[model samples]
Target: MTELMLKYFRKKQQEVQTEKIYDTQCPFCSMQCKMQLIEQSIVSRKQYKTVGIDNPTTHGRVCVKGLNAYQHAFHKERLKYPMLKVNGEFVRITWEQALEQIKDQFTRIQDEDGLNALAVYGSASITNEEAYLLGKFARVALKTKYIDYNGRLCMSAAASAASQTFGMDRGLTNSLAEIPYTRCIILAGTNIAECQPTIMPYFEKAKENGAFIIAIDPRETSTTKLADLHLKVKPGTDAALANGLLKVIIEENYMDEQFIQERANGFDEVAEYVRSIKLAEIEEITGVSINQIRKAAITFGKEETGMIFTARGVEQQTDGAAAVRNFLNILVATGKLGKLHCGFGAITGQGNGQGAREHGQKADQLPGYRLIENEAHRTQIANVWGIHPEDLPGKGVSAYEMMEKIDEREITGMFLMCSNPVVSNPNAHFVKNALKKLKFLVAVDLFISETAKLADLILPTSSYLEDAGTMTNVEGRVTLREASCPCPGEVKHDWQIIVEIARVMGKEKYFSFSSAEEIFNELRLASRGGIADYYGITYERLRKEGGILWPCPELDHKGTTRLFETSFAHPDGKAVMVVVPNKSVVPKEEVCSEYPLYLTTGRVMSHYLTGVQTRRSPALAARNIESYMEIHPTTARKYQIVDHSLVKIESRRGSIIVRSKYTEEIRPDTIFVPFHWADSQNVNNLVGEELDPVCRMPGFKLSAVKVKPVNDVNI
Candidate 1:
């Protein structure tokens, strides 16, 4: 039997040479750092090692996580087959059994509870082709109105703001290669040094070339240390700081009147609001003083070429979208957009965040970033699907809103793919409970993720290295991710799995996709004339070029690597300056007598979101084994908490225990913790569910809490 198994393995791998390499990109972050996956054989075992590939995004540099991506793809606990919870134990089940069960459960739920009762939640990590199929699966196969992805938790705020402000949303307005020549950069609530270290070299080059750098964050993160100016704004106060900066820009005559007159609109209203903002109030809201704000504003306003990059730190708040818009105001007011090295972009964190949102997977959007609510956009997609416009469901709720619906028993069944909301969502305890309420859940994942543990049936799926599809990077570069290996066991590509399920549900014709390429071709047609035009982005072209940026509307077009060079995507051919009212930003759960400290959550070096893949990575796991709260030394003294001491941090919503790591880099009034761990260590457990009015993003970045030493708690 052993010899037969060895022969089977040998036959499967085709007796390949150990040194064989497949060029691919890292499967983790939006940077999509190019790397070569090398096949390694030890005795009867085969694994992979990655070497950096010279590319526009990474410039031949890969982060520690990128280097270890292959390890997690073949992690020890990788799901090998479909599993069903029988008698409270996950038992191995054949694919037929799993599909039959899902079909029966889903059909019954839809019949009894209506189509809206079944929800489809997906991930940003999956390829763009996979996202588009899942969206189709939900709409055509199930005809459900509830469909959303994990990106709503992370990127929706920035997407909302950018769309409303610029009339189109691209992760970066200017490609990353242009940053080194930029004269100034504002790192707004993004820790690129830790979260996206590979791309930091561009900023470093710009710094060497005399570019002024400004970092705005509550904690003095690695990103802040490198900045020429650190605006340590109080937690949840990003909007106030941004509004005040715009105020200073307008008041000091730093805004370009000529540019505003020629290329933008609605600045007069924004100017009206900016003038009403008082400097004293701004200082009181953001911790930075008036003098610092003026200096930073002046440096940015006076710069010939500059860019502003924002992240979750500013986008995961109760006012996340409004805050992001306020930040965009500075760039627009200065007439800095659409020019080389002058624009605004949200720093996407997920591997395919840029493409995933352009996608049909989003609740309110169709492929090509077309809005579902619009009759024309709906008709366009409906025609591509060969379905009547009436057959397509209307817009659904946001990600967290879907959780609420599940809790209310409105959404009784869900097809969860690739996302681990139990660890990544706000009020995670609530999410877990709400997920538990689902009568049926079919999860497709490479690993038994935190969310998968609760699934009624879990399907093993191909890992990133074992799948071939295209993903859009943070710079809006849509690049291909080639398969390095075949699925080791019964595992299948995610698109294949979803198609199989669709066939079982009696919708095979609509989803009869033979390959990712075929699906991508349909996506191109679906997105042809929409804002995020992909008509010309063919697989043939992707392989030949480094990467092609979107709005490649024609076969002869080389793609718009530099966005807004000619005009914004709006119908009027001009950007809009959204008038963000100057108001004091308030935390959803305010810091008060009981919870006397501000608690913020973020990523740490060596770890990725939810730690599903990164934690399974032996090296990355060892680098940051146990979660710890970063407490200011002064705050630590007040709480009698010593370094490495376990502390109980309680909020109005939930409580978590983590060892404290004293640091002076954080504000004394605020404590920081990384949200890469699960269970009690999951900081999302303490985060509130207050939705941003514009973006509907939960307040994941800011909360109120109090900490006590575990010993004191025991007493």
Candidate 2:
């Protein structure tokens, strides 16, 4: 980490070279939306711009966010060198000083409180290789049992549902190419219009092909416009609604008895549970008419081939995993799986959400999505890491639990990697307070994010355009992100940064990765024989095919586009249809006299999660300058609030003031807020600290709040 070592370690690109174009992807969402980066170089400077490319997943339709993805790298606030917290203010420092100090502080913390005292909070936005390296660095060099990622907030509930229902976790059960031919499509909880605008064409094509589309949400979004039937299901009643669908499907005799008998387990329990769910009760709980519910069930249940999609809005509930499982129960009962045009998928939100979670970044997982506590899985990963099986740490607590540990002083230090939890985590103020309690915090980011500003030391990392690694898109397509240009200044790829720190700490024996590809080579070996199975996915293959889906276990094996083509991943070659009783489903918060409105949070088309990167784009920044609460016109009238007027919204946890926009786009008793700003404008400031018991995913979507009118404002 010394400047001398860094001088030797870093290679500068020579005098101006011929301009070139490289195939890459946008850094915003899981569409990873394929794009071309045109790089213009002058000496040590690089200016890059993005152009959308045709692909099966997005079909060349990149959003405004994707088109301006490269702007953040050129932002004035981008970190050019490591910065040390000197006398409560960040000051430029050599990499040597920062890393040496971090080593000393971390070692001292571990000596005082044990190895688990230093935890790692990773990101779903980092590449697969970097995610693998992060897991290895923690378990091998740092020897800590605490490591988790941002995906716990985005996809953990859906992931848990997939693994429980299908015996494996892949973002999509089938490819995006097959969507057009489906007989029906059910979109539950996902807002495709804003979050995944690029994939809209696929569903539109399905509509053209005479397919029926059903949308379920608490709000009427752009996606609802495309649905033949829109079920405005009440927030937190996802399980009840799903149970109602199953009940109607059974009563209508639409269940595929032959398929269930041959391909699944626990169906009898599922059937028994649904038998007790009455449509009237479901109507009361979900706030959807019984007739509409019956019609939707009949439409989808009678279809021979169709798909069901779920996202964070529905999966971030207290019974999130169970709610997802309930949807899967409908899928299994319908038998619209294991083939083309018949599938289930959880739309991913982060750039590397699917890939990062598969490669050992989660607290209870190893590479290949293997369980950490399983002896055989532990031994396999231990052998690949060149460490004893006993040396591997046991399952650690989740991301939110780590915060509690920090508050208790059990974890005094943390390495925050590429995520801005201060603004993204539920109960933002509480997370920030816990972060303040940490004895040492090192944040890796390209700019001064909300969390980075609070770090004891901040390290500069290369942007997605400056790094070459593999990413798995929403359809489970693993594509390579070719570096469009080299890292500028003293910035380094995250993998390189970790490797240098490991070498400096004298753990080079296990952390000496020369490049991203080298780390990927080891990743393939580590992933062998496990459920996610990335052993056969090579960089060359990724380029040749544009992308390849996983479970490709042999060099000559073709990748699996449809995960459950024949048999399930469970030991018995059958999926377990988890029976979730509707009576057990209850939200952590409820609408009371004080907090009478149901508050839901989501994304706007112009901004992405945490908004650290997209907010830098002049085009996007101009489109959306700040966050606003979307209140129904009727609801706004009740509080004496007018259109485009500033208002204060308060929850049990906290409160924030924001401009209010009155529209009829949402439910009368509900409020919608976009969580992309900081300070008083941050919507997450009012979010609760409730987490799902199974996946440990925070209930970020649904909360209870009260609104009061403030100063008048208009857009």
Candidate 3:
């Protein structure tokens, strides 16, 4: 360890002398498993070991990602100080110099090209306090409408669908504890066994209790192995399969007439539209048997209580919003929701994906899921911040659209924090080019991520363990993140960085804050009357109750655990039944003689999104060193490719070379690649930039490509 490391750890040790263990939540996924970091001394270095804590979400279970999270704080590559790009080379700089440069550049951009030239991109991993402050800083200090976060890439499709159908956007309608009591579960798109391992116990328990599980995917995963039935649907055809299931439920007279007539609207139109599709046509489009579709529909419709859960597999496509709505159609038509242990939801991927979308981080949203275009909402938030409604900016484009127009001079400058778009964005090669077209770029992170490498200014920020705040999990539960460790060198909390920048920009009146707790108090005032109300929550209450769900409007009110038990959030007290058409599973770059295979991207068990922080951990990196393509044995044989053979995958967007792992788990006409690697192994290079019409989510799950043995091609 270096002198700086020793100084950092010694200070942290002194602060927590009376307490040997500090409780905190995992920084990886939405499970938010509770864990205790026990202090340890190794030679001259101070270390902490992660142990599971008894909590409602995980019941004292921890995943590999949670156990290895401590390794990130002391990694050799951790950024310790601020730096500036001088003549294409990064040079050490003071915080004063860095903030001054950012303020000057922001002022110059706004003066020269107008406020639309400035933008800020936040993260979903940070606390709700930080996310809220970042949004305020963007709208008030920088006065720019172009502000968004990485959650747009993860859960925007589901959010859009849920809001339009249910009058709100929450990932789950009930808690994870209720999974075991459900009679049936329709698991689609998400492989919870690998992506969120802690939640797998609930599914296992449900299966043991005789609950029928239907796993729908194009590949056989750990999740599929646990299912009673696996529907190998073709990529981009999820909406069609869902529509087919709805048709089967209607034809068999499984529709609950009372529920449809009293608790929902627009069912007759949806039924009429689904009746036009034949089961055989759906089988041809989705590559699933008609019998299998009928069996699954019967299981779902006949069950007294059931649930439907979806994830990125169906949420990252061109028809993602429609696919999600169609899945909900079955639940609404069969009277499956608004009952005990029955609902439909999307499994959120990020740590604070639910909270980030609920707050003002999204381009078209205000605090507490309020629309930015709504004059009343703008006035409410503006009043809390001591500003007029007219001072607030209007809605801007989504994350993908913002990046797409960068080269066209729509976005000239950006402030990026805690997000690495270079490794995570679709059509990464084009994103790289778009980033370069920006006149100025500032990145605030704990390490020099791939996206930070392109920044003109890099500001060192504290990690989750070194900061204290609250985070909302997938179930809409807000939990606490304890500041267990000390920030090294001159690193500062993200909220403090935004505050200092705003002060430097002559917005001190609005940005004044002594602590994160103070910011949370203000956030509660801003969210009092909105959909995701947080007025009743407090730091003391969270510590005493473990975690609290949203819509706790009064101080005496307990948090709501299950929503829509009797009535929906809509003024009419009913859910909307949308009639979605069965669209074809065709990519913009269709398969041809040159490119005959379908390519899809996903995550692996050992790493999180983009592998920015996980890649630094020796344990995680050792488990998977580089990206590999998974191909069916028959496809490999047809291409003259053997197991572990190097292959070059070419698409209309770009190409990448990766080692092929032959397996029978995947479909014969499609291949799978993990999108966690950067540089030469980046799978996003081969992904197209097509956006979903409703949510603007990039179609990352489908791209037409062809594979060739590396030996047959020259380097």
Candidate 4:
């Protein structure tokens, strides 16, 4: 046979001999794209191709990161076997020995100190069952109430405000899938283009439907490019812009007076308060024109139906809670409550941030989205736990505050599960130091992460592909199923690991669940008739429907796609219109000559919230390996730094050496940096712990820094 013919025949044979279908979701971000693995060759692992399924929530589109999901599963850094750090290096150890040692040390600590001295920190990536088990293990087994998740950094402020005003801290009232029905969509502080790319279609469709779209951000990003009006406001001036819009809404009489009088409260006070905020005065503070605020407000308030969405931008500031309240004021005054397409929504960052908060991992919240401090909520959760709610600690410090108090010996022991805070946490230098001061540190990770390197006992855990669990997306849709692959090496599922540790600590009674299904059933019962109101959903119903929205707590109830369609969740069935005044919370009052540039840091589309999983992917690394500082071309010229040249960014907190990418995408006096790189060069190292007063979220953005050319070409 001819050589070409022989080659063609061999290729055909290879395809036929390759492995069959393997099912998995894109591991990069929360918009989990279900993919099908197609065999390409005999020896090589199957490559994934996105299934042409009928699911249109994301419109059958995937981002650059989603297309490369296999990279994380097959990465060289994956924890293949259990290892124990002996002396200064990690050494391979059997699962039996590692578990035995962890049990011994943790038990000894529990006997020596008290339960409050030991804390267990879980993650938003894990399923609700895993989170509940971890918290139960900490409280019942180790007898500690200091259990929290990393969601505190992602959505605590918005959750706090929503709970206060709406009587429920559940997910967004309107699903992103329902965005098409709106006449106007206002996004504040969220860069949906770069993060949460799956929902980009919703914003695009809103634009296509002639819905007025406004983006309020300090930086002009990809999402801002498509906005009908882009307000490049100053840092911490979100409330100013929001109030300025509300001022225009009141002055112009664009609100639905009938709805306000019938279905809302505090409108008179909100109007009186908004009258005090002059549009012209706020323009000076927000760096936006008075006309722009009026234009956005007119379009939004006058629309038949509108939805206002805010993300970490408004929720991560010093007055993040007020910023959220400001948006609520606009909606309530405009009479946009209790409707299908009109309300306020928060776009959460983490995959399971909503679920984790809903189920009982937060310091101030209990199961069923109830408050731990509220007597009624506490009583509900206490009933489920078969203990007095008063017996539980009232509330603990937030994630950031907890780290701050670590050195005071307030937090003696820590069990970090499925999270790498040393790399992702703001002010890495401070967090690393705090972890060092802990008397006992345990980390459960799929890799030997930087955070795990500091652990006294590390638990090797299975990845999402090797376990069965559910993850709630940003839109409050719950995706269910288990992995199709065998559990790799000696790694165990997070729940199984928690169960083992709980048994070792003599808390075996609370960890009696045989599978995630059994635990999820109990969670459904706890949430019955509660704020999240998952009384209609059941494990059996979930399997039959493939997916189901919450409030489907029972067998016969239909799920709700839009919230507050007829009645508001607040008292008197009316939404409250808060009188939000222009507030500024930027703490760095003055910028010295040494640090003249204002720095703003965030995530990119190609990487996850943190680069713990994405950084290990060669394809992702090839896209953007080293960190690069984004500065205006004029600023780069002033410093005599060539494009792509190495530079050192220094702040009062710390310093990092990174390359400079001179671009017009940044503001003149501001610089933008991606907060994904994990190393000394990480941009987060330069961010201080000075945080949002209401939310306790560190100021990852809005910091002063100085950038200078680095002569060393290798840097």
Candidate 5:
């Protein structure tokens, strides 16, 4: 495998010398750093070399993952054809045989077990057009209500909080260009320096202009290193810290009373709740000092224009929705929103996280970010598809819940696309077992991932470079991804595969998209009047303008860059401030004598999610060969463990052996592990499946665990 990868990289390097580089965006993270892919046709084999492109987001900058992303297309493990599992062994099969088998099995499952028995698990990495088609195929073809995507695990809580507060969910309310102009910026739970490196420069510019940057996290991350103040709060205590800051802001008379009285609702109720949180209690609940909270409150409140940003760290908690709401409440009370250089939002992680949610890959959504249960939304979308409104199914369970139901036969068959839940899901060991209970599983991906390994049939799909589609970035910018090379071997584009299956299932009228452009054209009409309206964004416009922000309602209208400037999306045009009482950070499975440490999982700069694509790149693998636990020096000393010593981190759920790196960056009572590796090194094995009630986002950040020397354990 290594030799094959090396040979491919060598050939790519040699071919790049004589090939044309096509402009495109990175497939790694939501920063969507624009880059150019040089298509090289060496002899008869095709390869690519990635180069940075000058764009508004990156300005010709690319990270390690972006620079090496081209290698994923030519990896040794690239699936070249369709295969079916026969007697525990996969055998190469024709596309017709695979499609027929899927049609027969899916038909039988629905006929016998009903439509609810079949499920579709989509992806956040696919194009908006592809995601829209998958949702349509699930409802109109297979007729399943159990449809969701991996984004549920990452951005659902943020989405829920945004919608509940502002009546619409788009990760950011302002453009990335405004970051440097804000007087203050508070980042909760996100490590932009490592996770989204291109964004760091904007924060740096803010600091250069005397802006106070506060980083609220338990660990001292690359982002924290740039902070004016680091509020090292305890894990899962984000709500308390936010409420505490609000308390100080209110007591000190720093709030914008005029703005609050004019543009916000429920301020009195939320302010009363904030007034109830005592500073002493806040210091105890969150691990930060009362003085630190006061400093953060004063810096944030004094600023005329500021922004509050969050990511998975706060959004992956059991109280994630509450945390996000409380965070937004601070902004609303301070009158920091609806103005230039001021806003509150999340830094989306996946490549197309914003677009995927808008286009209906989520369980509870339809095209144009409409609710699946809404009769009007159903009627509107059904009319566009030339189907009856009654034919549309109701809202389904979320991704994690869908997985749990698989063991109960509620969801007997699943079509998994562009995701590897076995390595990415919380409580991964349990997820793997639940996957085994499926009657039939169809995996559509470029490689045979750990999740794909359990599939009844696997279909090889083209990589991002071989597909033409649109992807919305973190700032809600709609960008184009152009096809620069032909797919390898018999591999097909994901949209083509979905259309073929839909045709085979006798839904040809609805799935007659000959090209991505045709599907995108339909998407424009479906999203015409919705919050994420894309009617004004065409492929030609995207090409000419580099990118365009959403809510562009007409061809002549320029896209909206700053949302909620004069009015919000709510009917009353007022931001809603929800008041949620403080909750404990400890999980239901509390820390005890046997398992006394708080375990948190996060990402590293070198590798992307689950290590599916990045792991294939030799450059990335060489930077971080395997996963290791980051233990505080005090914790390491107490446990009698040295740096680089192998240790067994065990939880009630499962255990894994990893090398320990002692550092002062993490709290003494907490351990941090990167959840990129599979098998024993997979940290999700130690994570609990406690989900946020409102959004169904799992608490991937906090778990109870115990660590000891590997030699001391009887393995």
Candidate 6:
């Protein structure tokens, strides 16, 4: 078996060598790993090692995916040219013919149902220029209010929560370097080990310095292994834990009175409400011991410098927006804000996820991190576009909401760029039907992925290696570069294709630009003084000086490492302490015995999110070839499940058949599954469409499900 596996791996590697260098950023979970090419003859392949730049923020280190990026880039299954699906068959077609077909179909849709009948979807994996042009084409050309990206699934809740409290929805207050300087770090529902692997070293170093680490999660994760105190609260009970922690801090007089009185509002009401809830009640609601909660509170209240980090796990809950608001309350009560190493930070999932939103790809936002609905922000964008502020649409439906609207026929057409929602979206069944219901669906991708297969038109685009663009990392550092390889076949860059499509549709005025460099330059000029500062930044300077951190306002001004220190940008110049009462979204009311075990999904080291790009790669496939569940041995025994045994994971929403690997790493009532599976064993098939009220993000982390041995002979 080993020999056979090695032979197959070598054969795939040989085939990859013969292919052209497809330089593109890894489309996995947003590290946007950079790649360099030095391919020798196809027969005797030669490649360069992945290298990390001396980033001002990250120093010079990448995670496992970045190191193995070349594998995904040179995968054999990568779509080589444009292909048309006719009568349930994908046939290769010329770029001209495909473009012509798309133009005709799109024109027909507009002529039939007005521009509002068509919708355009962008992706976080796309370049800033591509994302910007996509929104522009949809709004300016198509004149459609339906436009958004998949980042809504990752950070929309957190963004809405932050804006409601702090009046800004930026990524984070400090970079990963701030971890080493923190005296107390509260990791609320963020598992950095499996998600943001590159930032873990700083967390480890902070522990060495005696920094207190607190983890608030339903299940103990790899990040929790290093926690000084782990509050294993019940699922969707984060607000309860946060409220309990706040009550303890206030009752024990651990809060900073002077800071609270000076830089905050609504404290009296917040304190009054928090004081009403005793520690005992908090313990009952959150399922965390009061003593542990008190210890975590004391750690935060007593520390001189404290930081709080949240991820999708915290924001994907039904009460996610409330959980985020309460987290800010803890920071405000402890006086952790306005400091070099203290404040609230969000561990965003995508590499260009932050940049994607900043560049105006979102339905609610415009370029320069400005709100599309805000008069001033609209005026800013209008000035850039030489149009009236009213030209842009108000905030459109978010991703999950959009999917629901698709079934309702509120949205008729969709133009997807560099995103695969068929497998990645929560409640895959609903997404599949929604795509099928669309009057027209145009897909732009590097391969004919699951989502691509659902499209009426597919536009083959250049990979990261064949395009020139800038990608911003999680730390808010922006890197600029050129493509390493030439474009394969007639595949064009995303920006070029978007421009051409708009031009062919008689909207050439909106896409009058020639290159991505010009678009980037104009965007940088527009982003001045915003949280994502680029006033002093230029493509010429970045290409020569490497990437720079945001808030680089002027050439003389040094890039800011810490933000909102002296005072806030809000009207009152004070942060609000929103007293989020201890509330549970999933009481016995939400889930029942029919769907018993709590199931959570995340990424594995061997594969990336959805696995469309990574699974095609031979190296990644060799690492993790099959889909399996990580079930606690205790639960496995109860269900009579053994290691590598075929099992059916059934939920009220749906069910999937996958192999099981019994282990004690997870809790008995909890089962862990990676979202990387995309074929027969795709775990998302069983995930429900429940969402957080404010952000409208689906609850991908928490779902009740049952597991049983696959007894059928077909298995």
Estimate, for each residue in 1-715, the C-alpha lDDT of model 6 and write its tens digit.
6999999998877766543443444444554544444454545555545555455545566666766666655666667677787887778898778778878887888788776677777888777777777777777777788888988878777877777777776667766777887999999888888777767888999999989999987666789998988888776778878888898889889888998898888889989999888889988777789889889998798888999988877887777888888998998898888787898888878767878878777777777778778899888877877777787777787776788888888777888888888888888977888889987788888788888988877887877667788877676667775676767677788988888888788878867889888878777766875656677777777766666668788966656666678766678888877778676454322456777788877777767667777777676678788888888888888888888989888887678888898777676777878887775677778777877767777778788898889984344
Scanning candidate 1 in windows of ten residues, the lowest lDDT window is: 581-590
lDDT of 1 by residue, 1-715 (tens): 6999999997866755465687788888899988898886755777677889877678789999989888888788999999999988899989999999999999999899998999999989999999999899999989999999999988998999999888889999988888889898999999999988988898899999999999999999888988999999999888889888898889989898988887788999999987987989989978889999998999998888889999999998888898898888888889888887788879999999999999788999999999999999989999999999999999999998999999999999999999999998888999999999999998998888889999999999998778999999998999998886778778989999999999998889999999999999999999999988999999999989878999899988999877787777788878888777545244366788999999998998799999988999998999999899999998899889999999999898889899999888989999999999999888999988888887788888888899999998762
For each candidate in turn, the TM-score is 0.96, 0.95, 0.96, 0.94, 0.96, 0.93
RMSD of candidate 4 to the truth, in angstroms, is: 2.6
Residue-pair clashes per candidate? 0, 0, 0, 8, 0, 6
Least accurate stretch of 10 residues (summed lDDT) in model 5? 581-590
* Cα lDDT listed for each candidate: 0.89, 0.89, 0.89, 0.76, 0.90, 0.77
- Tell me the spans in candidate 2 whose CA falls farther than 4 Å from its real position: 1-19, 39-49, 583-587, 711-715
- Greater lDDT among 2 and 3 belongs to 3
Worst ten-residue run, lDDT, model 3? Answer: 583-592
lDDT score at residue 655, model 6, on the 0-100 scale: 82
Tens digits of per-residue lDDT, candidate 4, 474-570, equal 6676766457777767778889888887776666776787888888877777777777766677667666765566656567876766777776778
TM-score of 5: 0.96
Q: Write the per-residue lDDT of candidate 3 for residues 188-260, one digit (tens) a residue.
A: 8999999999999999999999999999999999999999999999888899999999999999999899998
Position 101, candidate 6: lDDT? 80
- Distance from true location, Cα of 636 in model 1, Å: 0.6
Per-residue CA lDDT of model 5 for 1-715, tens digit only, reads: 6999999998767765567776667888898888888776776766667888887777888998998888887888899999999999999999999999998999998888998999999999999999999999999988888999999999998999999998998888989899999999999999988899988899999999989999998899999999999998888788888889999999999999998999999999988887877999999988899999999999899989999999999999888988998899889899888789999869999999999999889999999999898999999999998999999988998898898999787899999998999988888899999999999999999888999999999999988778889999899999998877678889999999999999999999889989999999999999889888999899999898888988899998889888998887899999999787778343445678989998988999999899999999888999999999999999998898889989999998899989999889998989999999999999998888878889988889889899998888876
- Show the lowest summed lDDT stretch of 10 residues, model 4: 48-57
**Better structure of 2 and 4 per TM-score:** 2
Clash list (residue pairs), candidate 6:
23-464, 23-465, 24-464, 24-465, 30-350, 30-351
